[model samples]
Target: MSIQYVGLKEIKGSLIILEGVTDVAFEEIVEITLEHGEKRVGRVIQITGDVAIVQIFEGTVGLSGSNTKTLFTGHPLEMPLSKEVLGRTFDGKGRPIDGLGEILAEKKIDINGSPLNPVTRKYPRNFIQTGISAIDGLTTLIRGQKLPVFSGNGLPHDQLAVQIVQQAKIAEGKGIENFAVVFAAMGVKNDVADYFRRSFEESGVIQKVAMFLNLANDPVAERIVTPRCALTTAEYLAFEHNMHVLVILTDMTSYCEALREISSSKGEIPSRKGFPGYTYSDLASLYERAGMLKDREGSITQIPILTMPNDDITHPIPDLTGYITEGQVVLSRELHQKGVYPPIIVLPSLSRLMKDGIGKGYTREDHPSVANQLFAAYAHVQEVKALASVIGEDELSDIDKKYMTFGHAFEKEFVSQGRNENRDIDGTLDLGWSLLGILPREELDRIAPELLDEYYKPYKKKGSDA
Candidate 1:
């Protein structure tokens, strides 16, 4: 039999203090009944001796200290799992919101997730093609890797995320039967949520996506649970059903802000920028959940997108994220001003796991050489532009002038693409070769002699006054 207690200890922000509670486990879900028997849900966030503090998921409103009845469920929050989760939409707490009714659960798993042993982990290999030249050719996203997109306010990160969802696939013409996506949006506006849903449905990719949405006006407590619920679903699909799952988490900064708010309400001592000191571990708990098990056939790849606070990458949230994830795709405000859609700052963005994923049997033999050469040529383009600003473009040497033309075409034709345009790997690679043709043959130093002979077709430099 369960014990019921009349709550009257205190009412704080999103938390309600319950006195004389026994045998209550931490993180256990609670059932709160008002005097008139309106049901509300909560979770045990803190336990000090016999006093327990519960965070209400539906916000703490309309409850009196004298008339409230609380019951501890003695179990942590669990998400119902099945193959039916795909194409479904759920609230932050894993409750169905799409009017599809409840999931006939095959089994229920804890949202906190089962701890994965580091020794049993498998090294990531191969790449997930996003069909965008900038991502596929440069910062390649390997299967089972955790790569983040570092964006800022008012950038086009949302559009980029949508594009990836629509176009991402396992390499080498692998069918969609084995791939799926899980998207979580925390603290987004209702219109933005509607846009995400509409865009996916219109693109016909919604059937493979499961979305967890926590709106901006929702309780802050729900924001904290959003990503965990999304990952829990991904794990179920990947490990149980042997599906390669790609999980996209957007606006993680909002989740951290919710943590800070909860910490402030708990009266805990503040750390950097008034956030809890455990911020790093908290983020790691989410990111580390992605990977392939040594013996498992499936994998989970994560692309967590967070907007930098005040466009400052040095802020504590991004600074700590840099330490946890493999590498980042940093967006450029300068490129945005120049009418670039994705606005990816190529020089600063990279995937640490990319080298192992591309080349030979994976993407192409020339992928590594082409990417390295592009990085070198773009770096030189910056130098020539700086010199041009100082001494004007007309005074530059012939080779510098060639670089000027290459840079212009590179950004216009390569970095920028239509919102709906999707290119295959061969199309992207062939485009890279064509762009390299703008430079002289001697300038292509990164490729092997045989590859240069086979792929390089140098464009003749234009004569002065011609």
Candidate 2:
């Protein structure tokens, strides 16, 4: 029989200290029954000597003194797993809230999954097309890579996330039929969650998506389990079911905040910005779960989104995240103000594994050169604009004026696309060449002379419009 103890040596916030406890394992689930017969769920977070510190998932609101009964289940928290989980919606704790009823689990697995051995991990090489020119043509998202989207508050990162879910696909002709998405949102508003559901349903992709949502008003403690539960489902689908799964965790800043709150309640020593010292390791445990096995047919890729506080990239949340993920796609407030749809800064944005995913066989033969040339030309555009600002535009040389025209066309044509528009790789590359046509031939140093001869079209100077 499982042991039940009369607890409550102390109650602090959502945590309770129980004395004289035996055989209580760390992270073991505990059932707390109050004097009035109201029950709450908690987990053993820490154990020292004979005392255990339990964190209540439902919070300790009504409990008083040692009268409450604490039952130690002697097992960690687990979630039911099955292919039927897709198209279903669940709350933070993995309980179905979609009104579709309980899942007939194929098997149960611990939410804290085992890390894949490095020796058995295959390098991520294939590209996943997002259908956005800024991404597919520039910073390509590689299968099994962890790339994050860095944004500021009130930016359209949420919309971008939805678009990616609707448009992301494996390269054409790969003939891989099994693909899915595990989307987990932490501390989002009810309206935001509803938007995702409605969008997925309307787009007809909901059947292939498994959603885990923790609202802004849900118990903060539940936030800790949200991503873990979502990732566990992804691991099940990818490694066992042989499916390519994409896991999207939005607003990870909230997850970090929850960890800090729990740490403070436990009176633990704080690290940077009052976050726990183990924040990096805690995030690693979640992100490292994505990749392909040496001999497996499936893979898991992650796109973790976080809004930098006050637009500060140096904030601990984004600073730490940048260190862990492969690279970042940074959203720009300046570009948004200028009416860019995706508002990608492009300059600061990059994909570290992009080299492996693009080139001869993966994307297109001309992808590398096109991307490099666009980057070089855009970078020069910035310098030319700076010079034009100091010395009036009328004082600039003819070549600088041509660069000015190229800059305008690049933003209006290359970066800006209709919100609903989904461009294929060929179309995006074609548009890149069109924009490069506006610049003089001599300025195209990044492109091979052979490619320039084949693709470059000189833009006729003004007054030739007639």
CA-lDDT, candidates in order: 0.92, 0.90
The best candidate in terms of lDDT: 1
Off by over 4 Å in 1: 173-175, 459-466
For candidate 2, the lDDT comes to 0.90
Model 1, 131-190: lDDT tens digits are 888888989999999999999999999899999999999875553688999999999999
Model 2, span 388-461: residue lDDT tens:
99998999999889888888878877898887789989899888887888877787788889888887776543
Runs with alpha carbons beyond 4 Å of true place in candidate 2: 174-176, 459-466
